[model samples]
Target chain A: MAALALPILALGALTACGAEEETGTPASDTTRTLKVGYISGTSLGPAFVADALGCYRDEGLTIEFEPIKNPADAIAFLATDKLDAYVGSPSAGMFNQVAKGAELKMVASLGSVNTPEGEAAPSGLFGAKSIKSVEELKGKRVALLGSVGSATSYLLGKSLEAGGLSFGDVELVTLGSSDMVPALKNGGVEAALLFAPETQKAIDQDVAHALVDSKKAYGSSTTAGIIFGTKLLKTERATGVSFLKANACAAKRFEGDWRKDAEIVKMLADFMKVPENTISGGGLYAFDSSLAINEGTLTEMQEMFVKVEGILTYTDLLPADKLVDDTLRAEAVGAA
Target chain B: MSPVTRDQEAVESTGTWRTIAPGPAELDPRGYARRRTLMERGLAILVPVALISLWQLLAGAGVLESNYFPPPSDIAASWADLLASGVYQESVLASLSRIVSGYLLGTSCAVALGMVIGSVRLLRVALEPTISALYTVPKLAILPLLLLIFGLGETSKILLVALTCFFVVLINTIDAVSSVSPRYHDVGRSCGASRWSTLVHITLPAALPQTLTGMRIASGLAVIVIVGAEFVAADAGLGFLVWNSWNLGVPEHMYVGIVSISLIGVIVGLVLRGVEWLLTPWNR
Candidate 1:
């Protein structure tokens, strides 16, 4: 009896130790905190805003943001339930995950690149100084953030096709988004398709020239960013909706007066690790924060993905119904 | 004095032993054979089989989560998928070709340089200290510099493998040659053998075993270094498969890559053993 009592005491102590290590709180609590994962990319903006504004707390969510180094990692975390929600591009990777029977769904549109007042957004295709025109880029090397199946690669291909050049006419190298700028500067690549601030920085350095503004060629009607996860929408639907509401509010605050809200811009710039002047000069577009996942845009994206099945096949890329749930977005927008 | 007395004594001893142990006759050859077979089988096969069975059971029961520790069945299925898709074969061929090319080139150069230095005391004094100092530094620490200079391409990877192979082979060659007895040299001189002939026949053969051991060691190092090189900025190879799978969040595929790497190591070890057996059969 004494020996048994000793083991029971040790077991109790061990159980307490395990609980403390796991929750870092008293073991008596029944609730588990929400774990949100995000990459240090554009997706971080909304999460940062939500945390800073206490919007998650307002919705009664204890949120923890896990930093991811890549979009693929974020998607993987979501698939494994390690993360409650993540934002990523609607590429073959997302489709592949869904096809593998991962219980996940795309919930809302976070941001988009579109023209304001029917004017083309200022996007650029930069190349080395030696290249004079898009014609000169033919048979030359160009770099994209991923392989041919990636969203950036699709956009680049579409832009090149618009310029009367085929993807086969150029060598497409796979470089990460962060590496693209340096790769261009070092002459490792003949050209690169980059987003706003990096594009502006490249032009300022005079190491690369703008070949074309992609928005003018591809049109403003495209889905650029999305919020996705399954468990978060299922269990913490209100908190998820509140997150979108907070994003919409922050977007309005950021867009209402870009000149007066210098602090907001500085915060974003600091997080993105770009110079304030560069961010200011880049002229980032103000996206509609309605939380709506535009079906027409997604349908168009699906068609584009199907058309480029040679690089990656997503013949059954989810239809509009499976891709999004607009009821939450509508409710969040109405509440806001 | 003795035949009849000896027979009588043997009979008396047998009767005394039988009185002490009164049971069925012990069959010496059968019992010995049975024990030998059991010991040999237990030591050679049963232990490994038991360990593998335990592993499979743990994996099957999902004691460790599937994502983190996939079952052996899953690894086998993945292996089959890769093989059928031709990816596994191509990657294995590519890695093996690179290792063989780099190992041969590096080992040859090391052997030549080491022989020259070992022959001359002045050269040995000049080179050995520098070589030893450089050898003490981990080879991986210099990889970033190698990448900067060579770019993250085939050349840089192969160069690193070769560099690792060179150090091992060079050190072993020097030691082997330096350890040759002075008696052999004296005998050769007495036999009127020229320096070149003596080295070719006596010294080279004497050093072959150690040189082979160095090659074996470098061969393993080549595999490790090549895998590491492939981890950064690679589009294909077993290492790239592991890296891409990890990034893509396919931990199952990562385990598949790991198992493939282990299989490659086993095959290389077996091949080196065969070579050793063929070259130095007299040792057996």
Candidate 2:
């Protein structure tokens, strides 16, 4: 009886292992659907436009958009193998996921904002209106749209230090950009660092003012929006690159003639549930058609991320070249 | 005469052979007590020890991916961190206070309304169908509507708990009160007792056990619903803790929160059982 049972158990184990291995491998079929999860924040506009334009379908890829409540949830879903890609705020939280052996790689760059002359985008100590000047914001509450360890939060901390304000002097509050407007209006916070449309809303509402644009603060030609993933990039590189190319096209179209792209603007307005005039007047940031991830900007971002958030401890920071893969992006842009 | 005597003798011998055999010494009072004590002590230690050992072994072997399933050690560390930081305590206390307030209010209202409806056939006929229909619908399906109305504050969370608990207690109270025998009421009437007196002395005691059982069920349901209520738009609470950990992609912390919830459930179950035992000693 024991001898008979041993063989049976072994057979069962073998079958289970074989089954898992077979299913675990990525499907070889090029026509496989890619399910992308994204937060319904303004960051998702380009991706939505790309989807709307049938870019993914044109490349023989089926795209499905799953709305996540927050960036953290989006990242979690991506890490758990529930999503092929997640588009949300660039955060050190993503770094935490990467540290856990998830094979995620930043793929393509997206939208970036330019600062209006004489005013910086609202962010840290320098951005606080209560300070009257950068010197007065020496010890005040500053809010970031994400967590303490997030990318924006770290960048804000660096920006404050550069402007002669130490991070220790300012208290950091983690709040969403949508919540930040009301929070600032209520004086629950002194200033909040946020990205566009929300930043524009803040300025329009007169609840808060822009401190400094990220590009101005960093004083570098940084890529604000970038696509990141691994499995999808590897298996569906052409489709992924085409998706970015479509977004670039949309961006160019939006920048070239805002009036002509009224439909796109209207769609964005409907999704945001704000007035069309408000959206149009928001001075929305646009991305360039270049699919390349600027090496210089990434280096600065990595350094800032490490110094402030300790996202990658000194030993964990990989070489800059390995952080980005632009071959597919190049191919797609070349075809265009 | 000789054949009759032989048959009688065989019958007598068979009757003697069929006498009861002696039982084991442990069946006696002293031995039995000792055996029971030993069994109780063994049970007291064995289950927890076995569970902990298994958990530790599985965790150490990386059987369930530490980030996702976290080992006992990691959970313990997190628990310690929470306790030391005072965040866990504060959230637990806040949630407990809300749950208790909602539960008490719900139970009191349910009992009063149930008694009134159960006593009056007209009211019962009018209300039972509506209440039953409402009960058939899932309690969670109305959460969005509640949030819209209440704006994701304490009132909404408490209301959800109350809503779920109220129906359970109401249904149970109705069943308990209505199940009273007609004979008891008849006897009370024959004794020239007042309606109130009859209800207080005879009907109430008979229904108390079932009513208490209902309260017990409602209490457990309150805990479950309260957790769900806290999940959405909550800044603090065990449910919020689970949600936060899930969002942060710390699956182990999520599991820890879940396990803590189960512990709370078990504790609540034990309390309910104790209450049942106290109210219905006859069940013992």
Candidate 3:
């Protein structure tokens, strides 16, 4: 008993030490470093552009980019104050955390379907050769690029509605973006909701074709964005505002035929570690220069998740004001 | 009377060995041992309970972040909710089905192959090195290839568990069969026993104990590998529940899944120990 109790007591002491570490030092007024968690994807083009163009440097901030596996992980890190901000999609995790009183808020939009003409959809549902349309996906396996509660599931849910089917109509399988195209090719899934480069890959491989265009399926929907944790939300609001200002500066470069810009493409390629052609060839996400968040999309996401069941803990939708804070983006927009 | 006084009186009075019936006060010879066993069991239960209570106290007092390490009460509530929803039962059943199928298939095949290789010098010389090489390859590393071959279904997860159990049981079985005394086989042969008779009567009983121990170890490995495979491959198992709950930002549900997995591991260990006891009575 003493043996077991000793280790447990040691663990308690370690936890107490961690609590002390969590009470981090205050940031200086002149310049502050923000620990940012992000996933490498085309949707985060603005951040890559910001880094390459020295937008963050201009704002008197040092940005540390930590690559994370999932937006959920980012949410957890942000809530725990391990990350100052996260560049990822707003998912059930974010909403649930906010509902549970985690001091975090989605401050800016990263990617949306609202774009000018002739640009490819940022993400869409692709079907195998045998599956030509969403209607053909009935009773078939449809793979999602992330977990069931991820932002991609919103796109998938909306796309399925076009065929008069719900998320329940087809079997939903969760797979990583890298595995999406292969799963489609191998009949592991009849269709899949693919993001950016993977969507381009499915078309290039000739194994799958577009079943639903995300842009057409849900117009002006913003699911991916920048979210601020407690540090940015409460303690260091100016730093958060400056972070958004930097993002707004980068978003200016994302306008009309941005992928055609070799420098921008090369910068993104270097940051994301993919080839230049891979960044240049694929559809780039539409980003708002002012970082205008779509609260309606967020509310709708919660409702859809609630309808799906087992994703959201609460039955009722969390109000939009509780989930988002537009003041940071508004300040940045005014500054820009 | 006190046991020490009774013993002294008997020794001084008799001066010779004599059997005496136990007195009423000393009716149960194992009373002290029984009390010791109960005390050990009580301590076993008490330690975990004490640790959990400490965790609850810390979490409730806001020292440990409730978001990350929720109080045990919250976890218990989530466990009850999951049970009421039947999600917990379904996840357990899914994982158990895969584990059982994989364990039986892997162990039976391993024992059969091990017996053949161990009994024959030429086969052992040809196969042991290759088997050893394959054994050293991590089972989880082959998951992607298994998914590719088995197509992201239950088959891949089951195969992963089977592969994990296979190597452990195979090595132990080969060693156990090989190390059976040559004198026992010699005695069987001199008594005009056939090859089958020598194997069944002499070699089988000698190797049974060690093989059962290997089987017990393999059972635990099977559970671990199946849970890991479920994390990547399957959509309805305990690993998926844990991952999904975490993704959904429900720490309570994740804890429920984790606790369920631990319980399953403990139950599997106990069940295997019972099987070992029943199968190898001589070891008992």
Using DockQ as the measure, the top candidate is 3
User: If you superpose only chain B onto the true chain B, what TM-score does each candidate give?
Assistant: 0.82, 0.85, 0.88
The iRMS of model 1 comes to: 3.9
| Candidate 2 error regions (>4 Å) | A1-33, A51-54, A57-64, A67-70, A91-93, A109-227, A232-243, A256-259, A262-285, A291-336, B1-65, B133-153
lDDT of 3 at A253: 87
lDDT of 2 by residue, A215-252 (tens): 55655434445445665566545456656666565555
Docking class of 1: incorrect
Query: Model 1: per-residue lDDT, tens digit, B70-152?
Result: 67777778677778888777777767776777788888899998887777779888999999987777777777667557754
Query: Ten residues in a row with the worst lDDT in model 2 chain A?
Result: A119-128
Q: Write the per-residue lDDT of candidate 3 for residues A1-336, one digit (tens) a residue.
A: 999999989986674454334434332333567899997777778976797899999887889999999788899999999999999888898888888889888899986766677767878888999987899888999998766788889989889988888888899887877888999998999999887778778888999988876677877788778988988887777678879999999988887778888988988989989899988888777777988998999988887889876899888788888889999899889967
Candidate 1, A193-291: lDDT as tens digits: 877667777778888887876666666544444455775566556556656665566555544324246666576667667676655555455456665
RMSD of each: 10.5, 11.8, 10.5
* DockQ metric for all predictions: 0.13, 0.12, 0.47
Which number leads on TM-score? Answer: 3
Between prediction 1 and prediction 3, which has the larger TM-score? 3
Which wins on TM-score, candidate 1 or candidate 2?
Answer: 1
lDDT per residue (tens digit) for residues B1-284 in model 2:
12113345556767633333344452497887888899999999999989988988887897855656667787778777677878678768767877788888888899888888887789989999999998777777787677556644578778877888888889888878888888988999999999899878877777778888888888778777777766654657778677656655555556667777777777877887897788677766
Candidate number with the higher TM-score (2 or 3): 3
